[model samples]
Target: MLRDSVTAASADRAARGRAARKRVPRSAHGTWIPAADRPDPVGLLQAQGRDRLPELLPVRYARMAASPLAFLRGGAAVMAADLAAQPHTGLTVQLCGDAHLLNFGLYAAPERPLLFDLNDFDETFPGPFEWDVKRLAASVAVAARENGHKEEHVFGAARAAAGQYREAVRRLARQGELTVWYQHIDADLLLPLVRSGRRRRRTEATLTRARRRTSLQALGKLTETVGGRRRIIHDPPLLEPAGAMDTASLRKIFSDYRSTLPEERRLLLDRYRFVDAARKVVGVGSVGVRCFIVLLSGRDADDPLFLQIKQAGPSVLEEHLPSGPYVHPGRRVVAGQRLMQAAGDAFLGWTTGPEGRAFYWRQLHDMKASADVAGMSPGELRAYARLCGTALARAHARSGDRVAIAAYLGGADTFERAVGDFALRYTERNADDHAALGAAVVAGVVPAAPGV
Candidate 1:
């Protein structure tokens, strides 16, 4: 009876996927037109910062105004509102919410292979799967243009990402549950893709750098001996020591966060005594949030571990989509990360921070790495785009009806082509929005601190 029930449910889901195409045809996905009453992009960005620290707001504005690509990275709220106004195929999935090209990267876990997957989850929520696909495509287009690629190359890169997303989703649809669940993109997969000698060496070097990005490696760069003991160095506006009050707050929250972890991880965590901590700035979108780095030592001074405690806010997609399972913002981020990543972090957890704000804890850098999109050649960018697309499709399969999405996408390139068209059109608006932020800075409407 259980097996019969499961099969019947899947059949109905597949039928629902196919039925969605009638209401919003796959061809409709290619179009992008701004609504008459679209909210002011700058106003949307400012509204998201209502709860953020006032001091670091300038840094966020500066980083976002640096370039069009940077604007796209930080403008998730603006993009979310725009996409909500568009017609979408109703195949819902747990979206990364901000699935830009850079967000998909190499993530390393203890004792497991280095797998590439979506690493950022601040805006993760369940919504139409195509929203993520469109965002990814738009990011590729913007990056390609910034890299000075011609029109043909730009379209090619965008189409490549969308095409791979469609194909990967279709392949997963044909797979059984465990197969899709267990699937991971091993770092070794990158080796075969780069056939040329020079590119191979570059790729190898990048991988080598990632392997060395552990907490032990960070000891020298982020800290120094101060009066015969290691302490986090003060870098002013970016990295500063969490003073007495913040330090005490962190200590009190430690026990609450520790209980959220698994028993084994909690035991392992107990071995390391907290030594020093600092307030650190991170990411374009996450700049003004309360993010802190903790230093822990184990066995001896040589052994070290770094953990990041980042404040969590409501997802940018929350207003447009139905309410999700998690009521707490921090728990939502941790849960979404666990569901999407093939092999999730053992130390990931969430808890309430000072003033009842939500925050999540995770290992700072377990050998993480992201691609250098600014330097990629056109061919390399296209290949990287396709790989990112494949990885995203794999993540979606874990939380959505894969068979239904595949049926809606069909066995054709129509979806990909349409998305490519949409990406090109969308980037035009992104350019104007980016300019608007810069113009606001010039007009003194909002203060900015450049080159941070």
Candidate 2:
């Protein structure tokens, strides 16, 4: 009787949430107007560069200036500010914060099945759930445009993604909490959903490639024999040796990180001894950040482990949304990843770097593969967009009030079309922002290495 009463009260609250949010209406989310006090987009990019590694800022800008889609991927802060100014449902969730198309991927779970999910959580924090949906929908439009698709197709892709998200959320909301929590989309289950054609073949190939990306495979590709020892090969501007101090301080940092892991994981990690470390420039937005690849060896040179220690700064949403409870930004990322992902890296942990910067550690490229957006056909793009939407909804349902969100979306195309419209306009704005950044590069206002 008590359980029934509690369920009734919860349903009432969800119903109230739906009605309250409808006052703002889903269509209201379609508009985007720059505030008079809005920060200049290029200026915002420059502001972010201030605290990053000075030498690598040019590489970051060069990557962003390459294309409009690249610019969108790199400018999470710019988009965060824009989204914050737009109408929101006022429903908060732990967001990916940078949920662009490329961030969703295939990764192997500890149980060995390859699963598709959100693989990046750098900017994650509690924020308006629609912010992530907007970012994702906009990315689809931008990517479709970059692929030379017609404007109608671009908008169609965006609408399909939003529609999938709405439907997935509603479906998940009806399931029991344990069922929702344990749910995952594996490659076997996903491949059948795609029509049997070139798209299916492409996805199969990606899964095959991902399965080969184990620690052993990485050890062979990234290391070499040096003075009878296996050491990471240095490839400058992409991969290079961290200086002497890095070697000296890493022992302490590694110990501190091990302490953060659970006892079983700590015991598992104890077998490997740190061998060498390297500074690696990674991703569009993360190029200037302090990212390092640490090499560890177990019994022999053939048995190795690669851990990526990435610097964690404040979330892009931190300035616009309610502050999260975490004092350590690395812990914030780890916690968010654990809460959202069905399964996370076994070595996932956090520690302070030598210079007091908070950093999160995770296994580097453990059977991970991202979608080949550059090569996707119009049909494939639409299909991939829908998959991303479903994966995102699953992630959000794990943390957000799914019943309330499902109620707010209701059973209509209104929210989907509104999101599609927003995506179209934002893609145009992203192009303009890309042009502005490109001009800054040419004018030498922002230094850039064009081919890098």
Candidate 3:
């Protein structure tokens, strides 16, 4: 009976996909326009700032004003609004909701292999799969422009990425369900896939750096020995000690978080006791959100475990996209991440703060690193874009109807060409939005802590 039900559901989904293509033809995806009632981009950003740390909001604006690509990274909410206005097939998936190029990276799996997958899920939720693809393609185009690549190269990168995504989804759709669920692109497997010598070397270098970024390495870099006791060092606005009330609340929250973990993981966590914690600013888009690095110690001074407890607000897509079943924002992120990633952090869990804020916790630095796209040559950037697209396809296939999505994409280059054109157009829109933000900063309408 269960088997019949599952098969029936799959067939229904495939039918829906076919019907969606009829409703919104694949070629029509190239068109994009702001809605007549589209909200102001600056106004949307300011709305987000209301919930963030007041002091660090300037840093967020400055980061966004750095470049067009930088602006795109911080403008996920703005893009979500635009994407909501665009035509969609109504196929929902566990989107990395902010699926920019920089969000894909390398992290250590349980067996210690460096695996490449989506690393950030701050904006993750169930949304139209095409929104994620469009964001990725636009990011590629914007980043290419930032790197001074030719227009042809920019569009070529976007096209290649879209093609890779379409082809990958098709390939995964044909595989066994178990195989698709277990598939992961490890660094070793990824290196051979890079045809360019420069890209291969860059991949190797990134892997080397990722391997060295363990919890112990982070302990050395972020903490210090003061009067025979280990404590998180203060580094001005970027990293500083949490307030007494905040620390107390976090300790209580950690207790609640431990209950959500597996028994074995909880047991492993029992060996360590909370020692200290500090507020640490991180990432271009996450500067103002309350992020903390907590220190835990075992039996000896050398034994250490660092955990990051970050505030998880509503996903950027929550307002614009159809809502899911999640009530806790942190749980939404944790669930979406586990559903998308092949292997997730063993300690991934969520808790609610005393003030009703949702927060998620994970290892501070467990062998993680992102490729430096700015330094990549045009050829290398194109290759990297392809890998990101393939990774995104794999993630989407995990929770969405892969066969249906692949069928809508079809064997022709219609979807690829449309998305590529959309990417180029969106890049121009992003540049104008960025310039507006810069002018706002200059006019003193928006506070900015430039270069911080």
TM-score of each: 0.97, 0.97, 0.96
lDDT (Cα, tens digit) per residue for candidate 2, span 261-353: 999999999999889999899999888999999999888778889999999999989998777989899999999999899888899999998
Assess the local accuracy of residue 108 in candidate 3 as a C-alpha lDDT between 0 and 100.
Answer: 89
**Tens digit of lDDT per residue, candidate 3, span 354-438?**
6799999998888998878895667778888899999999999999989899878889999989999999999999998999999
Q: Put down candidate 1 lDDT per residue, 134-245, tens digits, no spaces.
A: 9999999999999999999999999999999999999999889999999999887776667668888888887888888888999888999989999988998899999999
Off by over 4 Å in 3: 1-13, 193-202
CA RMSD, predictions in order: 1.5, 1.4, 2.0
> Cα lDDT of all candidates, in order?
0.91, 0.89, 0.89
Instruction: Specify the poorest-scoring 10-residue window by lDDT in model 2.
Output: 187-196
Q: Estimate the overall C-alpha local distance difference test score of candidate 2.
A: 0.89
Candidate 1, clashing residue pairs?
none
Off by over 4 Å in 1: 1-10
Over all chains combined, what TM-score does candidate 1 have? 0.97
Q: Report the error of model 1 at residue 182, Å.
A: 0.7
